[model samples]
Target: MNQNVATSAPFLVFTDLDGSLMEHDSYSMEAAKPALAELARRGVTPIFASSKTAVEIIAVQRASAITAPFICENGAAVYDSSGKILTAFGLPRASWLDAVHQLRERLSLRFTGFSDWPAERIAELTGLSEGDAGRARSREFTEPMIWQDTQANFQLFQSEIQKLSLTTLEGGRFISIQSQFDKGYAMKWWQARHNQPRPFLVALGDGPNDVSLLAAADAAVVIKSGKSDQLDPQGPATVIRTSIPGPAGWNDGIRQILNLLDSQQLLIY
Candidate 1:
């Protein structure tokens, strides 16, 4: 480990949690242990880019011993490794919810957002334990809602959000409404702070919410989902989908990407 020795180009790996790195239903990353170990061995950086709130992602970070900065709450914010807040770009939760409340009454939209649900109900809906649900409910920026309405009305609701200069995005379980912030925005901000030469970004996700994050990456891994929709992002990088699902797919995908890089000497110093 000589200080004068050179390394390959900096590579950052950003990933979604629930359905990409962790089991979709079981919420486990135990299957991807080998890939994680290999990436760490090669000095690769993996950051969790997720729709989960800061509190929720922090819990996962602590449990998994991942110290890299993370993108959270549908890219509402990014936090550094030490838990210092890097940015707060999303709309205020209270103000956003207040508007949604008025919109619900005015449009008669049958929407039940996280703000309306108790932690127990949230836990039941998500199959998360009660304690985990509490962390999930501590939303700081985005308001994810379950819209119980027709597709036509849902389209109309999104139109209304656009008119208000707000936004809506679909996730694994809910649709998020908030400011113009997104996963791409968060990634760009975090990348700016790195002083290294332009790094190769490797992002992975399995849901619609991760489209932007995937699109922003130099190489993207779209994990397969049987119960959810596929992610298709418009980008110039190499894109691949795992035939298998969850962390198993995650492991296969990362290893393949590394092999590709090494064969091409793509990131060699």
Candidate 2:
């Protein structure tokens, strides 16, 4: 968290899951709860923007006791506070499997397509380790696509999917294949549809997957992880870097934002 940010009611806070909010191993939220509640008390809302499925995002929202807006599937769907389906925008409905089948036939490449499949089925397709496959399938928190040797396949998939008017986002493990999607598009849609206040917006994320929404915010914070380099390669003013890692980084980071609020006499208790 950076001390230079502004904090005011009606502020919008967007955060990424996994490495940004929860520890890689423990998935803890002990420190985050109070900060969230405080934001709610101050009329600030927390929006979850992550490369997770709708089902996974719903469960996390419930677990965190947050009812704010959520961006799922790396900004494919946005859910409002009441849990109503605010909007769905992303990849065209053409069959991805059919596209892959066609591309592989024409370009001579290997590829696979997955929907909301069971853990075992996903593991079988991607040949992921048992533990990794189990986590992906369990859906206790996140639902991510599994890709088998993604790099080579993704390039081909991108060109092919584009033919069908769709795009793919690179998940750390699995590649999220969908119609052209970007977190910024989803965020802008939310802002436009809701006509929400233009309060100081803050976003925090880790991973190359989060680059777009990180750039969309009034102020952005990057968790000191491998993906930090992906943000503002050319440099940006509103971007801030965190020193801590994972959930600890979130705690320290948000605290820094809140402290800035305190300094400005904006936050109460």
For candidate 2, the lDDT comes to 0.64
Best by TM-score: 1
Candidate 2, residue 187: lDDT: 76
State residue 128's C-alpha deviation in candidate 2, in Å: 13
Residue lDDT tens for model 1, 225-259: 86334667778368888888899999999988888
Q: Estimate each model's TM-score.
A: 0.92, 0.77
- Candidate 2 residue lDDT tens string, 94-169: 4454555566678666544453466677667555444445544532212245555557666765776678676666
TM-score of 1: 0.92
> Once superposed on the true structure, which residue ranges of model 2 sit more than 4 Å away at CA?
1-8, 92-94, 121-154, 194-197, 233-236, 264-269
Worst 10 residues of 2 by lDDT: 1-10
**In candidate 1, which residue pairs get closer than 3 Å at backbone N, Cα or C atoms, i.e. clash?**
none
Error of 2 at 203 (Å): 0.7
